[model samples]
Target chain A: MSHPAKHRPLIALVALFGLCLSVPAFAQFDAEAAENTFKDNDCHKCHHATKAKKGPALKKIAAKYKEKKLDEKEAIKHMTAGQKVKLDDGKEEDHKIIDTKDVKVQTNVARWMLSH
Target chain B: MDQRALILGFSMLAFGSAMAADPASIDWGKIPATKLTLFYPGQSSYEWLRSEGHKGASSETARGDSCVSCHDDAKEEQRQGAKILRGNHPLEPTTIAGKKNGHVDLSVQAAFDAKNAYLRYQWKTQNPFPGNEHQYLRFDGKEWKVYGFPKLDKVVQEGKQPGIYEDRMSIIIDDGKVPGFAKQGCWLTCHDGQRDMPKQFTKEEVAANALLTAIKKNDVRKYLPDTRTNPSDWKTGKSVEDIAKLKEAGAFVELIQWRAHRSHAVGMADDGYVLEWRLADAGKDMFSGNADSKTHQPKFMWDEKKVGYKSITADQLRKGDHFLIREQNAVPFDPNAGWKEGDMIPDYVTSREDAKGSAADNNAIANWKDGMWTVVVVRPLGLANSDDKALKAGGVYNVGFAVHDDNITTRGHFVSYVKTLGLGAKADIQAVKLP
Candidate 1:
């Protein structure tokens, strides 16, 4: 069987695109671990996929943060420092902090929220 | 050939064929079907691991992600199969070694007609061996002793907990009656301070509390917001006066549970739907512990003299329906009878008449075949009961689903996100329109 030598450049380009999309923002960033932290921190109870429950939708948060050019550090500070978020009922509650000592995990979790 | 003899032969053949037909068989092929993948609800608010202990956590501030949002394919992720042994909160690592994990892949289908809605689920259990053993307080040749406990018990935590529990399937429905269910789903009802939590209530506490006793239940399952003055409060300081007010206000959620070994024994399941408010059972379970303390014999036998315990060996238990000791009529525990250490009697069976108005109206049929259980649950639409959230036509409602298999129970079961089930229109999680 002869190898397709003419398609080598095309294959290389495709592989590069896949790697760019798959690489983590940080060296220590773990998407799966961060996702687990998101659930454990009770982030899912209020935010939904596309709809607003108690707070804003996650997609909305992702869009707003992305548009403003927010980095993982800023996202982590917003989540851990307990910013006041307005509810649908116009009531405000202190944001629940992501309870973890590892700052790397926290940053990874923030990146996940921003990725959404 | 004699003409008269030939005519008589034809007449006999027609009569024999007529007797063989049965009308009770369900025509599942005619029903509209859709297949879905159902995974376990990873961590509910009740089981969330927060820094400030289990206190101060409310459904209002819960995370927005659904189970599927994070852990999409559970079977591959949780392959160890023993995560349930920890009961969602393990102070220590699980002691049971080499046990299966939580990644169950389920196939679900839904169909409805004018009167009833049918939901079918199929899943291959982690343990190839079926677990039908249940809690049995047996006679130890002297005093009647509690022989076995579910895996959650402290005594049973070290690979000692008998893997004896009924596989259960439940549906949480919200039809505009229960508030915040569509947004929060089952977590609205299953929060901190309930049974099997970090701050669990003792049996004495359940017996003493007016609200718990009024509902005739010993465990907490689901509670609505209005049922408590502070929906986030998990304390037990409320007086009977407070509970009475909540009851009068009619703050409760409809919880229907179907146990393979419990309700399937006496051939009644639709009666298993229980209404829970403020973590109390609004109705009575179909089968109760029917062993007479004095005699140790079952108060209610399967009319065994009428329907003998169908003899079944271990090989016959591989597939289809098989006889379990829990499904048979109880016999008196005889201390002098030289019973073995692991010997047990059939769980007490209750008749249809015994359940009465306390039963919820839902029907179920289960068959175990090829390391899998195919369960069919049927429920009527537009029930007039005050507690039940009537499943209506042309209305979209929030629904949560949970499955308890492999002899585990409580928060250890798998859960789904709050999905929209539209009767006739478009929905986020569709339960297709029936013709």
Candidate 2:
């Protein structure tokens, strides 16, 4: 089932283009802007890159959402909605609402957290 | 005068005389109580309050915003305490299994007579039984060793020792002298290297510290930020002479603690101040260590003739009062009284006669009943002692309160934000003038 040599090159180019298009847009999010928002809101007080403080690590959060087949919409909802969250300490508290209303900014930060 | 008027006049005269001598006789029903919610603080030291980890409030705190400004909601302390008391919270590294409550409602009332200012406090205990027992000296097969520790101590956490500690109520007063006290409260004296706090000092670090070595102190305790050139660093202390000058100017917070086991038996509260260190006044306190340092044995034992026991066993804890008052119920410890491996004696002894000078100025009366403690602390007015804050009439002062419970000490206590207390003038908790 081998293709012709000339056809093989065209197929390879098509496969490469498809791979590029399949990459998630989260890879191209504005990381610096998202981090600034995180810090300005003091989210880093509980969250860290890889280590858990009062909140879960960003990497762990990202993995959890990914396993559930969720995307940035859920992350944005968590940031904006003041919902009850169970912490690592087995205590429940209202999650801190982020300090912004702009959908663009919220989307960026959510994508940034998922990128971890 | 009519018969009813005559009887009323006689009763008023008797009440006045009793109130002057005894604060307990004050009509507490006439005085208004200020309700304060004291919450478990965990390891949130002065450094933690200003660090980036404090979240959105760090900058505000650095700029002299009072804790109450941001946490002004009635339920805020309860919220914070419940979060911090749980296991693995950022503030609480170690958790006690038996601790269930995160906050306590402290009812405070104040009144001033011509001779003394009376502060009455009441709070419910977390445990059903009162915490009147402290550490003990337990005899093993060979020699006596220290037994029982605070719930937060490593030995208690590891199950090597049982949790046993006294409950305490403390008040720190600043008479508009120490800067930033009105804004920051007790956090100004709590720092990074203090015990059970963030960046706790190591033994080696304490030994090498210039100020600690100069002061002959082996452990770090509560200290004012002004004592150090770098307010954030405990090691960067100013000269002793500078601290002396600060003391002369009354730049210190007066610390008065009423210990359930130590000074309560003698009806006195230990008087001290916080400046370069948490220091006692110019003279002796009402309590002293009972164990002999040289022989590692108790210096005094219960008078068997009175208490019917030379030493108690582990099962006798909280069953009755175990205080060994030197002038009343204690006798010299004897080595040949059929000593056993399971016998236990108190670690501290109390004495009212031994307390002297400024340290003996504060008096207290406390009773625990129906799972609550009602305490009245009597402090003399117009004290000019260099070690004390002169609580004068019509003077408003900054005051902070703390309560230790649940067999714990150090940072395991619940604390309150700063509040203004006026002797006669109007403030947060005004002290009414007694008739």
Q: Which candidate's lDDT is highest? A: 2
**lDDT per residue as tens, model 1, B294-394:** 76654443223433542222223333322222323333333444444434344444433345453636556565667887777666677765555567667
Candidate of highest TM-score: 2
Error of 1 at B73 (Å): 12
Chain A only: TM-score per candidate: 0.71, 0.83
Candidate 2, position A31, lDDT: 94
Candidate 2 backbone collisions, by pair: none
* Residue-by-residue lDDT tens digits, candidate 2, B386-432: 99998989999999999999899999999998998998889999999
Q: How many residue pairs in model 1 have overlapping backbones?
A: 27
Q: Which RMSD values do the candidates have, in order?
A: 9.9, 13.4
lDDT of each: 0.55, 0.86
As a whole number from 0 to 100, the lDDT of residue B210 in candidate 1 is 69
Ten residues in a row with the worst lDDT in model 1 chain B?
Answer: B15-24
Q: Which stretches of candidate 1 lie over 4 Å from their true place?
A: A1-116, B1-43, B46-99, B159-161, B203-210, B213-221, B234-250, B270-284, B293-297, B300-342, B358-360, B428-435
Candidate 1 fnat reads 0.00
